[model samples]
Target: MEESTNIDQCTMEQKEPRKVTKRKFRYIGDFQVSDLECPKKRRLYWNPTQKFMSSSRRKYVTLKTKIHRLKNRINYLSTLLTELTECDRKFPVPRSIDFNKQFVTVELIQGQFVPDLMNLIIRFADSSK
Candidate 1:
């Protein structure tokens, strides 16, 4: 009877499922910019990490920086145009003016630099038009 009872207990233990210990894995160290492969996935991960900041915020910051750069470029171009106009008025090339009257008159008013810059501007304007 004791042998039969031991066998029954063994069978019961075998029939029952074993308990599994669950584990959560966490990453350490800084998140690299190269790690973000997918833009859609970037929106999903909500961990408040200093390394991997929110995508929307990063985009906003980048856009602001680009706008600032564009504004600076605009100011630079305006000043450059005004300076060029002054140079053109100071030194007149009557022949070129009559020949290309329709185009914006960029002339060689000073040293080698002015001619090079004027040529590039002329080429760019011609291509754009």
Candidate 2:
């Protein structure tokens, strides 16, 4: 009887699903900004860049690239926040907006924000108008 019980316990253990660990995503170093440029319209524009260690590739990469305008800073941030929330619902996307400098920063994940995803979001946003 004891041998039968042990065999059942072993079978139950083997039937249990194994837990898979996910690789952590983290940012490396400090955020850097490109030189601000003033166009003929006298509007200030700049690009904010940050290096992040890709969770899958395990290498440093430039993940953020967006030109920010000083005039429409608030609108830009709001639009990005709304679009991101509507498009990606799986992982929590964290974003920081610098009103003084007129730039936005976002924590990115590999395979999360591909060009196609961004294009789709942009098109969706535009179509709603």
What C-alpha lDDT do the candidate models reach, one value each?
0.63, 0.51
- The top-ranked prediction according to TM-score is 1
Q: List the residue pairs that clash in candidate 2.
A: none
Model 1 lDDT tens row, 5-100: 999999998998878974321232433455467664343333535335566689889999999999999999888766766894664433334655
Report backbone clashes per prediction: 0, 0
Evaluated against the true structure, the overall lDDT of model 2 is 0.51
lDDT (Cα, tens digit) per residue for candidate 2, span 22-123: 533232222223212325212221111122223433332222222234447879878887787778565467656576433221323445446766898999
Give candidate 1's error at residue 17 in angstroms: 20
- The residue pairs that clash in candidate 1, if any, are none
User: What is the clash tally of candidate 2?
Assistant: 0
Off by over 4 Å in 2: 1-71, 88-91, 95-129
Model 1 superposed RMSD (Cα): 17.2
